[model samples]
Target: MVVLGFMFISCYKGRLLPIEGKVKFNLIKSDTYTLLYMETEKGYPNFNLTIEFNLIQHGKTVKVELLGVYELHILLPAFGPARGIDSLMLTNGLNNLLFTYGSYTDYYAVQVDTCIHVIPIITKFTVYDSTLYGGLVRKPNIYLYPTSPCSVIVKLSPNGRLVKTIPDYDDGFKVYAYPDGSISGTPGYLFYEAEIRDVDLGTNGWCVSQPEIISFLQWLLPEYGFNPRECDDFIQYWGDKLTGSPYYEIYPITLEQIDLICP
Candidate 1:
């Protein structure tokens, strides 16, 4: 009789082990985008589910075909290793499958029959610029180029300082500046070149010349939205302060008027 009672309890526990619940699927609309949400049971909080499906617009019996399934799980201390805690899986057809459940007394299940819409893409504007400076005492020439004609935002960093975020360039090409004071016409095209005149000397003499123009040009070309290519020097000139104050000033160009000039 005791052995027979043990068999009956084992059968009852096996039946209780399988999770029983229903998943309620819903298509939610946010501004221009659509998402799928699932709610298990009557009072369970809705969880966002990542799913992709094609919308079939037919004259009759419009149905959702689930292309794939996704799962997200979390382990709880008291529940041992609860699998498929707050997760979702959708079928290509209009069927929702019951996954598993959380360890806490929460019931788990899946409900089908839902739909979500896709969002539309929007475009905006931005600005581009290039600049050069004599690292010793001269003010840098901040050249504002013609605005780019796209919806991408262009941010300016001067001496690694976040100057500002410009909106929408009406100019045709992207503008970029190099550390050695060379500007690229486009992101990769090296259109113009300027020699870096180091006023203060460390180991080098009075006028410091950097031989890494080729490499420096390579680095700045990508930032302005162009590929690196060789270009000819446009401006060649020099100046010396013969006065009392040993200050360096950019000749023939002002600090504020260095607009985007390609070689």
Candidate 2:
């Protein structure tokens, strides 16, 4: 799911009216097909409206307009002879959505009335083989910081098995959290690995140089709410291996996707 913020007007009683609200874009995968879901906070309450769905990719655009629709959750049709998953992966360029496992970038737009919204969608999926028990989910350390002392219960729903866990998961971690970001009767942080049988790697990512890697993380980590020490620790852990190559491709997973993959 990715949110490209914009405001739009609503149509009511054959009149165009301005409304102040936002909408969300989601890419969902099912056993049969991939679907695009669009929703808005302030939508047509009592009726439906005609909408134009626009798809742009690799310098080409396809447009489809529908009548009497509220929210959208449509299975994209075949562009030519390509059909089903192959059709989605080939022509619609949805294959680009899988940057790593289930991560994706946007290539769709929506038009209502005269408003056009271009969105960049990002998604993440983790492929864990239940039979072999193998997906090396790397460093996942939990940091808890609250306003004051409070009891905290942290739980994980890994698709596979947990290889390591601090404080021994014991179904869930029960601890006392404090303002200083420390837990009583446990390590200051939590760490674990969710492993499965196989991993699917994506070829799409930022190919960054060594110096750019340092500078980028220095800036990017802070934007994601990482404190100075945490940021330093992240780069320190992964810096050496990345710098070995002239440039390395970096794929970032969103917090939302993380929860979806292993809530």
Candidate 3:
């Protein structure tokens, strides 16, 4: 049931659009092109008009225009036809309607009439490249990444279900704890149990960037006192063997070696 585009401002009785029977699809215009798509469920509000803008050009106008100095961040009417195939190019005959998507084209302009219906706002996300266990802050600890790194930037919670929930990147981004103590959230980062492996920086390790993986997981998890080291797959075993020689340091950690072991 691909439904998430909704908009209903009100006023267009002679059939410019607002049919409400939820028109399925069959209006491929030409009086200067008029075919729109992507209307989700929330667009049940309807639309008409009441224009007035100068907060630098009230997004130009959805119609009822007088002038237009300029401004952008536009996504009018119920919120979107933005899922892929988008269009709104009409300039005078239709009174102005420019709203492109992705790297954002046309920038922004509005004002239209003559078959325009769309509702699209489903762009959730989740992916990684690598990370696992580290103070992502206020810990229940179990981080790992590897599914859309860098290019996908970083994002998680497409709700694949990791109910253990405890992810917060403070918003300024830059949350990497990866010397192998693995923790991530730059631009975007959200992972949930991928069997976990990748973080064996070994050979006198030296993390490489973002201040050496945040000084190697706060010097390998040491909050005053001393004894706080986890890794042998984060010790917590049962049927797969359990015990106490639990000392895992996938290498790469320093702060003068936690000031030579918890100074």
- What are the runs in model 2 whose C-alpha is more than 4 Å off? 1-130, 185-187, 196-205
Tens-place lDDT digits, model 1, residues 1-263:
00000000000101122222333343333343323333323221112122333444343222333332232211111111111112123432343222123422111122233442222121111001112121111212233333443222233322222222122233422455454444454332222223221211213112212333234334433433332222211111011111111221112232222222111
Off by over 4 Å in 3: 1-37, 42-84, 92-166, 174-176, 184-263
- For residues 20-129, could you state the per-residue lDDT of candidate 2 as single tens digits? 23323333333443343333334453222222233433433432121112221111111211101111212333233222111222234322222222344432221111
What CA RMSD would you report for each candidate? 27.5, 19.6, 23.1
Per-residue error at 199 for model 2, in Å?
A: 7.8
TM-score of each: 0.16, 0.47, 0.19
lDDT of 3 at 263: 17
Over 44-102, each residue of candidate 3 has an lDDT whose tens digit, in order, gives 22221111121111232332111211211121223212111122334433233323222
Worst 10 residues of 3 by lDDT: 3-12
